[model samples]
Target chain A: MALDMKLFKDVKTIAHAGMDGLIFYFSGEPVQANQRVQQYMLSINHAKPDWLKTLIPSYDSLLVCFDCFKVDAHFVYQYLAAHELTHAVSIDGSHHQIPVWYDSPQANDFEQIKNQTGLDKSEVIKLHTSYSLQVFAVGFAPGFAYMGELPEELVCPRLATPRKKVPQGAVAIAEKQAAIYPFSSPGGWNLLGLCPWYYELTDPGDLPEFSVGDSVSFYAINEKQFTEMANDR
Target chain B: MTDKLPIGFVIEDPGLCAIIVDNGRDSGLDRGFSEGGPLDETAYFWSNWLCGNAEGEPAIECIGSIAFTVKARAAIAVTGPDVTLTRNGNACPSWQTLNVEPGDKVTAKSLSPTAKVYLAMSGKWLLNEVMGSAGTMMREGTGGLDGKGKPLDSGDCIPIRIGDADKKEVPNWLQPDYHSNEPLDVVPGYQFEHFYPLARRRFFSADYTVTSDINRMGYRLNGPAVTSDVQNMRSEGINMGAIQFPQDGQPIIMLRDRQTLGGYPKIGCVAPYDIPRLVQQQVDGVVQFNECAASDARTKWLLAKSKRVRYLTEK
Candidate 1:
């Protein structure tokens, strides 16, 4: 039992996550960090090996919530030594082409983003619609997805003071993450556009096509298109 | 009165934080919705049991004068901290089932030392289900009278399933004496053994007062500053009742509406049965946390659950 833990000493660090949870930390590169955690999460979900219950993946760590009565610390140590993080990216991962009304009247953040970053309206829009980002994690608010590690050139800071209420469907970016206001709630992210498609994309499931580990790309659309999608929901 | 599977209750007042809730949206956790049920489950179940309603039935929870008028005679129960309950123009005691006549006014409020209260109707509330829950996930904008997580507003009519026309109060109203100084059962989690021995000792020996800062999300405790050498712990799913140590050394007991992922290092989880009594503690109330094994906690929970089921079924 002692030697099993010694074999994987440098690869990962295992610790108690909670009464029924175990935390596994991996010192992996940024590119494969989330996937590595997801791989571990999938194993617990798919196999429930050793009485595993549920798995939550974050940056480079995976928190495994399990049935404590069914397994012990020895079981976790052996499991960690036996299984390794996989390299297989999900083939079923989806890409959503979200339409946006950038810097429109309601958004009114184009000038804000421009002044803060010294980038003009078109430049901001170009950078925002530049490429799709993956949903790294979902939290803070229900249906709120954290899409992240925005392109370095486009990274922005949070507002000086958060608004009392950021209307739903408002697209914003802050630090290294971008998120859409799922419900009309207070937030500090710097607004860049309004997707106006929240109802269309946020029902049936917490997020329509915005599952974690999936990718999303934005496309510039006229106000008319935005209104149409807004009404579509 | 029209015959319907769901009985209707018209709202005359929508108190602060009033919403339709049940056991919670536990299944919806993976789908990005937090499990937002009642903060006081023991009180919630007591209300349901008094009204002969089964488990997982929807009910109203609030902190103010949540008044309503019924279109038909109905049996209902309210439970929680002391509240000024009025049936029509007559004052009434809570914690037991009471029958109300058509047009009878029902209201519950606590002006001083306010705490949450649960009102369980004889029939479950009828509402559009989101992920199979009528309980409102306020942050998610789903579930409730309207499909948008809004609370019962003035003039709102809630549909409910009608049941046994005869109404009888429970044999005895449980006015359990909950001593704030009593130790809250804590289930030792994975990180329990890692906490400093002295810190663990202080946590058990000392009494932590519930701070004024509280909500459906969690209750913040102010007491012995518990510090851990590790900072910036990775975020993960925080089960209801987990005592989390945030950046500041204070421990916050995550409740039903807690965020899906939290970064604070949690020392342990409160036993599920203890959460009911924990939620009833008023602001500045003193509470002591005691460590117990998860196995013991689970066994106790199962036994209590079975006892409640048997009691309700036989009744």
Candidate 2:
């Protein structure tokens, strides 16, 4: 099909995110408001509306929820403002690469992020594996994520006390963001190492090798390729 | 063969914080999970319709003094807030239906301190449903009955499907009072007009206390700060009983293991039929809040789903 392009065109406010949800709001840039919230979550999850249920998508809105006994929020804001964000087709998610290790031993703030970004440790793994970022919010846990801009000399600042554990796939950063955690909780970010990949759901549409407008990249491995990808996980 | 025989129950003690909930985990909120269910959805739908099950099935929940046992003939119930239950030691009746068998036992006992209970049984447990939810989610360790989300301790077991009893009860207009001081309601809606209308009239004329920093992801109140001129925005989706705030504006609420995404400033949600009386109140208790409209919270969730479809079609 291939030709449906009008996009959230800066919609601004749909509101209500409560009595059975419905956020929307689009006002621009954060990669075009998460590419119009991943094209309105791929056209309302491909119009599967049995009064939808949960859609979520963040970094600039698209909550949704529905099904208060089959609809409301003004019939889901007039079926999402009478549709038309166009889509002959768009997909673009899953991009990964990952593989960190940034000198593992969970790189406990590798010398306090090389003295708060004066950039050492191989220029903070060459500006955190130079560009690819963009997940911008998976959440505060479960395959964590939140990746982003960074590179203003590798940002920094988080961990004024917050590390009661932080192990699983660690790799972190703060300010302009970058993350990884994905299950070994209690973290305060700023770590910088160990990414033998983690998060594991196993069904109910599984997901999470990366999500939320996905696109990763990192790449620096060692410590025996993080012990052969943590013994091939 | 009699629904492949197995039946459930085992945890002989568990006590403070049992788990295995249900009707949660779907589309794991875009990969961050936390919809672990039943922080008192009307005492988990009257403990799954007084154990004739299916008000979202899979049960247990608990909090402070559990027990368990059974493993053959079943049918259960319990419901919460000021819990009690009992069984082998006799005293039964929390919201009705009981009948056990095999090793029997039962237990429950919270009596307050913001109870929590639930239990529910009557068939269909056979666990395994991780992200589609057999619900435990000890903060994403994942579902339960050893799907690894941990919590119901002392021996474990679970499995299910043998059911029987049929006794039921719970009618005093489907019981749920938990000492009803009432207020709660609140269908406000995200950022509810960017606050400051005297901070939404001190959030519906303030009272708020409940803060032992509650759990199952949120509750925290403490009272009237409200603020919200909407600063750093962008980070959204949150809903269950929502409320939010935090910049010392104190609020919190968002339960059923919350955190799917946030950025503070919420001032909404709450009316899911008053989120099980504010998750059964009691830390320092005291609550209040009102404004409900959104079609009167969808006609109080369609009259509580038409009283669970007229008590499951008159049983």
Candidate 3:
């Protein structure tokens, strides 16, 4: 059955208020529905009016924030209603390999996960790298993006206690979601690997490089390459 | 271009961290930037009024005491809780402007009580505006004089535009009370209904005490366990005054530097006007939450803000 876009009109209206924004609730299975929502938002973004700033897709719904001083909530509601939305669908995806060094002595949870999942280090790396992932949303810290649906074997709950600071470029996992830490900060996700990609600051002039519907892959590199990339920047 | 004269003095020492702040950055949270500015808005406004600056103009947020040597004559005012001013070693009044000679040594004493203080001068300070605010957010390392979130330190010379040096007296009516003890008004959030009904009842009826764990990021409250059986929640965008009840069941009121979004269930948000009351709350201070209708709350908020503007403009 196709998804009904009309069901979200009230939520979209409240979200347009630009004050304390609204959160829309969608009833569906978690993993499949979350991906569908992302695809739906991408279509909405493509058809969005020039006046709209951005439409963000979350796990279940879309968040739309506008400049209240310029446009009111009613106009936003009308705009969403007029646009016919495509049924959410996951597109055929491409994978970008992330070179990870799980061999570091500081790999705190490395041995623990190996113990729990009964998979050798090489098998673990193969499982993580082999799958193609989608960038679900950018949230939490600045430039921090949540991408997901890890293999069922790799899905694990977050650490009971979060570390005070997770280093920048650290690739971590929580439940079914895999993410890369854009900046060094405290987090609860299990550390698995690291990446060297930088999320550019939001400049009013520049287009966002990654959006909800885009595909992302991770490639692991050696310590020497990591140091070189760090210095080059 | 005319050379602008630097005006102002630090009478009473600014002890540790102090910086000029106005309204903070409107965006940048998506990139994980924290909004840094005066922790106490009410005091910040009063400080601006004392210096003869209009509302929204830059005012010095003295985390401790600020002492400065005046290079040019200018009128300045000190406001906020528990701050004492001394000019050339003599005590001075707060919420009122004082004219000083170019060589006067102005000193601000450590807040005997409150955590922050505000000092505003008659003319605007010379600082680059970054992300549309003069406020500083040191965590993301942006905004402030150099746009680096560095606070005012000793030996740092701040330049100020010179206005009428002769204008010294602050009208009696213009002086704000600076002391307001009232319960903060919160508008219930949409998720208010999600929590167990009994927990919601207990939340409204209980009095929470402010813990010492307070900063620009959040205020962790210690009170009756404001719990809910709901543990897991998808992360979502959070507002300025959101009252988040983490799994620990202790309610934490998020402030300016709070994460852009949160997963914890929020009971509601304290009204903007009542934010000052939260900022002024001291460790162990007990405060009760009162519900306000959204429409009435917004109207009262606008009126209060307008009054603050008028007070700043009064001669």
Best by DockQ: 1
lDDT of 1 by residue, B1-315 (tens): 224544567888887667888877635465457778888887787888778787878888887458888876678888876666898778888887788777888888765344778887787566667776888777677788777877677887778766653454543433434554568888766355556889888887898998887777788889998765644244456766888775466888888877666556678788877887788787888888887765567666666767666766786
Candidate 3 chain B: 10-residue stretch with minimal lDDT? B1-10
Q: lDDT per residue, candidate 3, B1-315, as tens digits? A: 113535354333446567667866555554444445567776776666556676688877766567888877788777766668888789988766788778788877545444577777778777777656777655555566556667666766666776653345445443333355566787776367667888888888788998877767788898888765544455566667888786667888888766665566687778767777677777788888887654456667667766756764563
Residue B113 of model 1 has an lDDT of 47
Q: Compared with the true structure, what per-residue lDDT tens digits does model 2 show for residues B1-84? A: 324547577788877778888878657687677787888877777777777776687888877568878877777878777677
Single out the weakest 10-residue window by summed lDDT for candidate 1 chain B.
Answer: B168-177
In terms of docking quality, model 2 is incorrect
CAPRI-style grade of the A/B interface in model 3: incorrect
Task: Give native contacts recovered, as a fraction, per prediction.
Answer: 0.28, 0.57, 0.15
Ranking of all candidate structures by their DockQ, best first: 1, 3, 2
Error of 3 at B117 (Å): 1.1
In terms of lDDT, which candidate is strongest?
2
What is the TM-score of model 3 when looking only at chain B? 0.86
Q: What is model 3's C-alpha RMSD?
A: 5.8
Give the TM-score ranking, best first.
3, 1, 2
What lDDT does model 1 reach? 0.70
Off by over 4 Å in 1: A1-33, A36-133, A148-181, A184-208, A216-233, B1-7, B110-113, B165-177, B188-207, B223-225, B229-233, B306-315
* Alpha-carbon shift of residue B39 in model 2 (angstroms): 16
Q: What does DockQ come to for candidate 1? A: 0.23
